[model samples]
Target chain A: MEYVIHLAILICIYLILAQAFNLNFGIGYQFNLAHVASYSIGAYTTALLSTELEQGFIVCIIASTLLSALFAVLLGGIATRLKADYFAIGTLAFSFVVSALLINWKSLTRGVLGITGIPRPIIFGRELNENLDFLILIFAFVLLVQVFLYFIFRSPYARSLKAQAEFEHAAMSLAKNAGLVRNLSFLIASGLAGLAGSFFAYYINYIDPSSFSLTEMIFVLTIIVVGKPGSFWGVIAGTVFLVLLPEPLRFIDIPPSILGHMRQLLYALILFSVVWFNKANLFPVQRGV
Target chain B: MSLDILPQLLINSLIAGSIYALASSGLALTYGLLKILNFAHGHLMMVGVYMFFMFNDWFGYEVIGSAIGCIAVIAFIAYLSLKIFVLPFTRYSYVLSFVTTLALSTIFEAWISMQFGVNVKSLTTGFQVHSIEFMGIFITPIQIIIILSSIALLGCLAFFIHYTPYGRRLRAFSQNEYAAQGIGVSKTNTSYVVFIVGALLAAYAGVMVGYETNMQPTMGNAYTIKAFAAMVLGGLGNVWGTVAGSYLLGLVENLSIGLDFWGYSIPAGYKDAFAFMIILFVLLLRPQGLFNSKSRAA
Candidate 1:
């Protein structure tokens, strides 16, 4: 039961991540690799605030989400001014910079040692320490985020954003500020990533630089692309498929070292095959006006 | 630092820069012709180095011969992979090709790790002397070879691109593939040839690097980033600019290392930070890069 709850919690975390990524890639058509960096910033912020300042869980989560959103604003300002590919490159550089800071800012981040012993959430005079309770909290948060995202996806704002993605000049002619829409989408997406990061830190009870590498970013990207971005259900389905698909490999009689490698292999193969087969419809090319 | 130390550092930087130039030029070529970022380019080099090592160990082939043979084998495999898997999807979205190549990179890395454990292996055939003196300054022979080979390769590549019929066709195709096809250029054949040539150049760099340093599967990550940096710095599709960018990057890195303010020595890990900082600054200041003046911003 504990294992099942743990898996459930992880699914909720990944759902948040995938949906946030979908917002940028699917709605804004921006391929930002720095999403993981924003996620890391949130994790570290919560870790530091709770461990150092003795802040409560709720305050730390809010602070983490805000900090991530602030960083996203800075990145979005630069990214929205450039071409799509340049945005990707710029975000990749931002990720490296964040990773470097996380590794080198030993006085603050404790370098590679990471932070530990983060306490679980406490709500209304009740401590949600048990796996079942924690699972409920996570699922509620995920459902809330999903509903919020669904509303945003259905709104006229989302329509305009999608319009900007399809043709920025056309959208502009229609009295839409495409750059502003992109910036808003990116900020929201990164804020959600931060929220997910806080939950991840609280659940894992440990946060490290290794947990937020380019490899992790690529995995999230794989999920977004595999699930066929732009649809809320598509992202949810993608999260479920990716998280659950690698579970059965645990029972295989392979060396532990090779087991980890096999998972990566399978992910790579699936990502490759999906992209190849769904090249046209999946991630339709957005023309710039 | 003394003058002698500065010269030595310069030589080392040149050698490192040369490797970046060689690998990045190939990447630029493919990007120019295909408009697809070949994420597997670094892995092509990784596989090539492993093949070179295997040929030397198993067949007892001479060092230079095995290097050439490794390049041929890698180029052939890459060509076949492109023909069989990539060519059929030429008309497809660029992102599909990008994802496919990235997956191929992961697959190659995994297969190599599966075949040979993640232990770093050193090549024994290259020059490994500590240092050699030249004009009151000390440098390694390998450094000299690196600089000379880079210059020679750049000159040859320029001539090939400018003077040959195939090269003119490639240039035309790079400009507009559809138009080139209308003019009777076979896009399939052109793409295959360009990819193979690019792979060969990457293989050559891999073998040379193996000779200079220890070979490992994870080295591809660093090389991949450096190549991308060089490509961006020089501007995509410009070979001369890439070569120039590599040397510029190398020099800046060496100068940073030589910088000692108030007797505090910056660790070598800061090299990546410095390179990336420069890349970010360049992106902000001049997105078109140093060589390409036309802004590609949409």
Candidate 2:
């Protein structure tokens, strides 16, 4: 029961992540590879505030979410100015910068030893220490974020984003500031990703640099691509499908060491096949940049 | 701080830059022609280095011969990757190609780890023991060989691209694919040659890295990023320009190792970050890259 609840909580966290990714890459048509960096900023922020500052849950999550948003603003302000392909490269550099900071800033991040004993959230003056309690909290976050995402998708802003994605000139002709919309969307999605990261740090009771690497970005990208981005329900299904795909392999009698790599191998192969088969609909020549 | 280390650092920079230059030219050129990022280029080098290791240990092949064989294997993989995964995606599927290459990179890393059990292996051959000293500074024969090899390879490539008929056709195709095709260049045959040469060059860079530093699965990623920095620093598609960029990158990267600031010394581990910072700075200040006046933004 605990294992199943653990899996559910993880899925909840990932649903928020995949949805946030969807809002940016899917709706905004911006390929920000630094999503993981913002996510890590949230994690590190929450971890540091809670452990170093001895802050409460509300204070930690809010502060981290805001900090992550601020970083998104700084990163997006510059990154979104570039053309599409260069935007990816710029964000990738940002991701590496964040990663370098996390790994090298021994003074702040503790340099890969990671923060430990991160307390579970205390809600309504009661500590939600148990796995079940955390699941409820995670589920709440997932629901709240999902609702927010739904509104964003339905809002007038989303129409502009849609127009911008389909054709920037068309969006411009309609008096939509495509750059402003993109930056704003990038900000919101990064903040949400931060929220997801906070929940992840809280639930796992641990935070490490390894959890937020380029591999994590690849995993999210796979979910968005496989789920057929631009559809909320499709992304949700993708998150669930991919999160659970490796579980059955765990039950098989494989050695513990090789099993970990085997799962990644499977993911790589699946990602390759997905792109190979879905090439035309995915990245058409007309959408070159 | 002693001033003696500066000269050594300069030499180290030279070595590091050439390493990056050798590694990145193929990736930059492939991206130039096909618009595919070739994320697996570094991993292909890692695999090639391992092949060199296997050939040396198990097959008892000579060092130069094994290096040659490494090129052949990677060329095949490059061609296969293009044909099997990359070419199927119609023209201008940049995102698809990028993601596919990224996926292939992951596969290669994981596959290498699974096969080799994540153990680091030294790849220096019997012939790598000799060194030459100048002005009380010692340099290995292998380092000189690596440096000279990069220069020769880049020179040969530039010559081929400019002087050879097929190479000119390939460049013409790169500049304007439809125009080149209209002019009767065999686009298909040229693409094969491009893939083969690009793969071979990247593989050669990998073997050189493995020769100096021991082989490890994770090493490919760091070098790949460095190569990327070098590539972008020099210019995206210009061969000689990238070579110059590589040297500059090597100097900065090596100089950062023992860097002192305000009485606080920076750790060597932070060296790679300097390159990434350069990349971010370049991407923002001039996305066309330092040496590139023409925008390769697309």
Candidate 3:
């Protein structure tokens, strides 16, 4: 029962992450690899304040979201100077900067030891200390965020974003500000990613540098890419498929040491094969006029 | 701050520069030709180190023979990776290229972590701890090996790119897309060659670095970023520029590692922050490159 509830909470957490990525990369065509930086910001903020300062969950989550958005705006401002592929590299550099701080700032971040013993949230003077209660809280937030995203992504603003994504010049010729739209998308995506990060910290009761690595960012990237970009339903389906993909392997007789590697190997193979087989549709080339 | 420290810093700087030079040169070639950031290049380097370890450490093969075997394995992996991960999506969208490389990176890193665990591993070079003194300067065997081999390899690369027909084709490909194709440069085959050569250089450096310091799965990310910074410092398209940039990075890094500031010394762990600041300065001041001109094709 506990396992099932835990899985549900995890799915909700990752659902938010995947959607956030979809909004930026899929819709805005902005490749911000520092999404994980925002994630770490949220996790570290929540973990530190709740453990050290005894702050409640609501304050921490709100603080995490706002701070991550602030970071994204700053990163986006500098990154806007770059072209398409260079923007990805720029964000990756920013991500490295964040991770470097997390590793080297021992006095503040505790370095690699990570922060533990995170406290459960007490809302409305009620102590919601159970896993089931956490699951309920996480699901409510996911549902609320999803609805908000659904409406925004389907609006005309998203069309302008797509215009900026596919051809910034054409959009700019029509008086649309590509830079502003990109920054807005970045803020929204990173802010939501931060919320998911806070929920993750609350659920696990711990936060570490390892959790916000390139691998974790790739996992979220894989979810949205494999799910089909720019489609909310596709991302939702992808999240469910991926989060549950490893569940059935518990009954297999593989060695404990190699099992994790094998799963990753399989995931890589699948991702490779899927892209290869569907190359015609996934990547339509633009021939010269 | 003192004359004694100058000799040690120069030696350390050269050693560090050699590794970065190897990596940055590879990055310069690929970025110049393909114009895509191969994010998995670092992970591919990790695979090479592990392959060397499997041969020399686990199977007890001779060190020289193991290095050859490791290069062969990495070349084969590089070939397959290009066909599967790069060729399909590179023409379509930048995001696809980034995603594919990232996916492959995750696979490589995960496999390394699962197989090796979190414990650090060091390559046993079987060298003495005592430094050899020459002309009042001390140098270790590993440092000597690093400097000599890198020079030989880089010299060979320079000769190949400047003289050989295949190298000419690579240069043609780098200068302009349509012009290269117009001049009968085979895009697919040349790209495969580019990927293999780039990865080979990075792997060679990675194996040496693994011998020098601790080897872990996550080491790839830091090296990749540093190599990129070096690539920018030297120039994007020119290989020799990468050489200069790598040494520049090495010198600046070691110089800043424990610098004295008005009778106070800085911490070594802040070296990465220092490296990042150098990157920022390069990007802001000389975004084209410090060593090479902007219009360079190779």
Candidate 4:
């Protein structure tokens, strides 16, 4: 039962992260590879605040989410001005900068020793230390985020994002304010990723630099691509499926050393095949005249 | 910190820049021709170095023979990747190819780690290290060979792109795809040639790096970013610009290591961040890159 609840909590966390990614890559056609960086910023923010300042859950979550969104302003401020192909490269470079800071800023980040004993959230003057309580709290947040995402997906703003993604000039001629929409979407997505990161820290009780590498970005990408990018329900289904797909590996007698890499290899292959076979359907080209 | 180390620093810069040039040229070519950012380019080099290790260090083969075998193996892998992961999406979204190649990189890293136990491995060859002193500067024979090899390979790339018919076809294809097809350039054939050549250059760079430093599965991660930095510093698709950018980067990095201004020096841990800084600054100030003035912004 504990294992099941743990998996449920993980699924909830990834669902929010994937939805955040879905907004940028799936809806806006902006492949911001630094989504994991935002996630890391959130996790690190919560980790530092809770451990150092002894801040409560509300303060940590709010601070983490806002800080991550602030980072998006910096990332999106530069990324929004670049061409499509260059946007990915710029975001990737920004992520590397964040990673470098996380590693080299030894005084602040503890330099890879990683913060431990991160206390779980204390809600309603009660400590929610059990896995079940955390799962329930996380699942509620997931529901709240899903509702927010659903409204955004249904709004006219999302239509503009889709329009701009399909053809920028055409959307611009339609008076869609593509820049505003792009920045808003990026900010929101990163904020949600930050929120998820806070939950991750609270649940795991430890946060490290290794948890948020480019490979983690690839895993989120795999979830969205497999679930069919731009589809709201598909992302949810993907989060559930991918989170559970590797569970059976634990039942096998494989060594722990190779097991982690085996899962990565599996996801990489899955992502490659999905993108390869769905080339025509996914992100259809919009040739300019 | 004195003038005595200037020559040494310059020599070191040249050596580092040569390896970066080898890595980024192939990256520049694919992005130039097909608009495909081969994220796995450095990982391909990683695999090549491992293959070199398997043949030379493990099986006691000669260096030349092992390099040939490495090239052959990487060439095949590059071709297969292009055929399967890259080419089909050239006409489609560029982002798709980018993600696909990113996945390919993950696959390579994971497989290498799984096969070779995540431990750093160095190549063992029979050759002895010998450094020659000229004008108070010392350079090893391997370093000289690496520099010469870079010059020769880059020269050959220039000649091939400028003087060869196939190169003309590639240029034509990149310039205007429909017009090139109308003029009888086969996209499949051109991409095959481009990818194979780029992979070969990367293989050589990987071998050079492995010979110079230790080998690890994630070693390619830094090179991938460095190559991207070089590519962006030189316009993204401009081959010659990438080479110049690589050398500039090498010089700047080495010079920064030697000289400290304002009583501050870059820490060892932050060395990798230098590439990101260059990239971020370049992308912000001049997205078209320094050498290529033509704007590609949409």
Query: Is candidate 3 or 4 superior in lDDT?
Result: 4
Q: Which of 2 and 4 is the better model by DockQ?
A: 4
Model 3, TM vs. native: 0.94
Q: Best by DockQ, which number? A: 4
Which pairs clash in model 3? Answer: none
Reference-based TM-score of each model: 0.93, 0.96, 0.94, 0.97
True contacts kept of each: 0.51, 0.69, 0.44, 0.83
Give one digit per residue, the lDDT tens place, for model 3 in B1-298. 5556777778888899999998778778887787877778778888888889889899899988998899899999999988878887776765667667777887788878887774688788776567799878788787798999999999999887989887888888877789989878798888788789989998999888888776888777778788777876776666788789889999998887645766776678777765666665666556667876654221
Q: Taking the candidates in order, what DockQ does each have?
A: 0.54, 0.67, 0.42, 0.79
Kindly indicate the candidate among 1 and 3 with the higher DockQ.
Answer: 1
Q: Is the docking of candidate 4 incorrect, acceptable, medium or high quality?
A: medium
- How do the residues A1-289 of candidate 1 rate in per-residue lDDT, one tens digit apiece? 7877888898999999889989888777787879999999999998888888878878988999999999999988777787755676678778888888888878888889999988877878687789788888889889899999999999999999999887788999999988899999999999999999999998888998989986677678789888887988887988888998988888878888787668778888888788777877876766633
In angstroms, the error of model 4 at B135 is 4.4
- Residue A152 lDDT, candidate 2, scale 0-100: 85
> Which of the two candidates, 1 or 4, achieves a greater lDDT against the reference?
4
Of candidate 1 chain B, the 10-residue stretch with the lowest lDDT total is B88-97
lDDT of 1 by residue, B1-298 (tens): 4454776677778888888888888888877787776667888888888899888977889887887778778978898768655665557655566567767888878877777777999677544487777776776666667778878877888887889877788899777778998989877777787788777777778878887778998777667667777877888667678778888888887778776657776766567776677677778788778888785642
DockQ of 3: 0.42
**Best model per lDDT:** 4
